[model samples]
Target chain A: MTYTGHLQLEASERYGKSVLSDAYYNGVFKISRPTYTDENLPLVQLIHVGGGYVDGDTYLTEIHVKNMAKLAVTTQASTKVYKTPHKQVMQRALYKLEANTELHMKQDPLIAYKDARFTQETEVHMDQSASFFFTDSVTPGWSKEGTLFPFTCITSKLKVYQNGRLVIFDHLRLKPDEDLMQLLQLEGNTHVGSLFFIHSEVTVEWIQKLRDYLASFCDDQYGVSLLQIPGVCLRILAKRTSLIEKIFAAVEEFIHSTIYNRSAISWRK
Target chain B: MAMTNALFPILQLSDSQFPSGAFSHSFGLETYISNGTINSSASFRKVLEIFLANQFVYTDGLACRLAYEGLEIGNLEQLWQLDQSLYALGMARETREGNRRIGDRFVKIVSTLYPNQVFDQYNMELKNKNVFGHSALVFAIVSKHLGIERETAISSYGFATASSLVQNAVRGVPLGQTEGQKILVDIQPLLTDIVNRIMLLDETEFGIGAPGLEIAQMQHEAIDVRLFMS
Candidate 1:
């Protein structure tokens, strides 16, 4: 069966923040505070809900960050794409960050089981003075001793506009069966994540700070470099899925406290 | 009879000694070497092979053919479209900049020596707008101006670039001279097949995927210090 889910967040002066549901079976996922947060700060909460299957072909997830509001969105558990006897599963995420707002978006690794076929497309747009930090980690699913996922292709495009001018445009497409792990490819990396942080007013000093913070979580081989433009991009490759996820979480919290001025989110036990 | 002599211009245009600043740029090889991903001569050969088969085939090879045909028909719009497509396909800033630099150098040299109106016009357009003048486009313009056959010019240029890369690998990877020559000899047959494949390409089949190369190129941008401009 096909599944489709959409979640929209709108800020209300009276309600603090409201999660609006358009369709799909919704579930709330909790994110715990990182061990590093200061004792005085409150832990943030993330509400995750997914609607049931529609036709098994297409699924949609929409996240909206309202003006001047901050939100941290993450998955409660690693999402598994089961092998279908017949067709592939397709999903898309549309994230909108309004002016003066921030979204610390991260997700658990996606494991594609053997014979499973999946495609994901993500589009993000951030307004002027807005900040966005997002990470997507993916891993090959469990298969028989030698077999792996039949095919997995994920394409993502992130566009940042400030005052109607295009500031940053990032597009990525990944296909695992094409031998992405080959030396000339990802250099035999099984787990990889692309972390991007964009803010027009970000200074060189700030970039260095971010780089140092990212460097502190040293488990895998990762590289952090400043874009000639205003943002910073980090690409990390690791063997263990859990280590990568932890590093991602730490980076997310660092960005939240320093850039967004938001409290850390406490993960659900 | 005419075809045999026609091949000379193709060879000359694609020659590594053409002085279009091709040797100065290792095309991210310097970065890879510094990072230790490419330590030996053998590893360099592997990297170049993957680069040629995966990236140059789809990108520069296809661009060369399209630009050659575009110039032959005097289709500026088609050429512009091809240029835009190349820009979009290039994900790394340094790689994109390297292409423009090489293209500009080619146009500057050719405009003074060859003095072709088409070359001058294209160069002017490139300067006025931020149009990316990639090496493939410039090679096409010069090859066509020199009255060379399209397939031969494209293939020869592609092969020459691959050879230069191998030579750079020899130096950077510290490979023996004989080993470098061996690598070149090994790649000749592959170049022939690539040329044939490039010839059969259609515009609709443009922009084939090569993500690893894109990532490597992107990674090159963040590399702290590098010998090659790219």
Candidate 2:
């Protein structure tokens, strides 16, 4: 439709439980009913009805978690970016979490097909006490000519601010037209992924333990870094997207079992 | 006369022996060294080339470009925003703090040594805790105040950065000084080319960092008994 898509979700705490207070979607965005899991954490899934992200298409998503509320959002499947000849497909996600709130976004891999151009910017603003977790992955989509790196461009930028101070900013600009591998120093690897977990309790000891734990499952291609603001980011470059996903799964498990003293609910394919 | 006026200060600031405290940080190289990812001079050079093209051109190089532009427009707010953005883009905690430390020291020493208004104003912000200082931004301001050309300032900064890292690699990788000098000499052409590209780069092209290098820098923090501060 050469138009912009929109989605807004609001969640709050009531009676010691989190609830989806308000929701809105238009232009090919659909949300499944909120499902509450252990600890009153509501899981919401976003469905893209537009088939695939087309050229010149833009999507805007705004999510708010009110005081002490908890929310988790996921995608049903991988987001496919089709050819964007005329212009690049753009997506902007804005998230706000009030004091002591928690928000998690587990996005599926972005598969960019041949000649595809995609740019996504995600910004999160949270209180000092709030907790946020985010996951993103990128994979080269189908190529008729059987090329390895077919996507024209894939750019993902994320900025997280706590209490109105910029803390974490990560920008990944991948262009197959350029020397993509050498440009990013990926060491001949293709798939790329990142997980950012921001919480006050994230300490050096905890991150080191997580790093040591992941060292068995993950190859030397992956790295875990602590943000100065009490958070950790794990980034990996791999030839297979599955490896990245597996590492992230391990990280989630570690975080839940060690820090939260709970089991992470399995995310089935 | 003007060229010499600018050149001497640029050289003084760019010298590794200067009191900028940049030598204390490796940013991410130490992690790779510990992991044996950068054991040889060739491996170090490959990583360095990638870093120069992929990360430094956008982050530090762009900061200098933007800082110079901000100075031209006489906008202190622009410089402030640049400093904040540079600080924010550093995902590694140790690397981020290390940059802040070097930049803080550079500004403090230069402002006191040169006695310029813009430098003092910028230093005041840092002293007053208004903004986290970044070396690239400070380098640009110091260069501008010293009447150094923008391209020269950027090239000098790039050269200085490469040489300092080369020194670190030589020490950490246990390579000889000859190898360090060779690596430094080899990157001069790259320094020229990167400076040119950064000059024409738009602000939108700024803050680009590779996941691999960033991870290395991040992991450097956890290495027990690390050699570098970053």
- TM-scores, all candidates, are 0.74, 0.95
Docking quality tier of model 1: acceptable
Q: Is the docking of candidate 2 incorrect, acceptable, medium or high quality?
A: medium
lDDT of 1 at A165: 43
lDDT (10s digit) by residue, model 2, range A46-73: 9998789988999999999999999999
Highest-DockQ candidate: 2
Ten residues in a row with the worst lDDT in model 2 chain A? A178-187
Among the numbered candidates, top TM-score falls to: 2
Per-residue alpha-carbon lDDT of candidate 2 for residues B123-175, written as tens digits (9 for 90 to 100): 77887887887778877888887788899888988888888888888888978
Candidate 1 chain B: worst-modelled 10 consecutive residues by lDDT: B1-10
- Once fitted onto the true fold, the runs of candidate 2 whose alpha carbons sit more than 4 angstroms away are A1-3, A266-269, B1-4
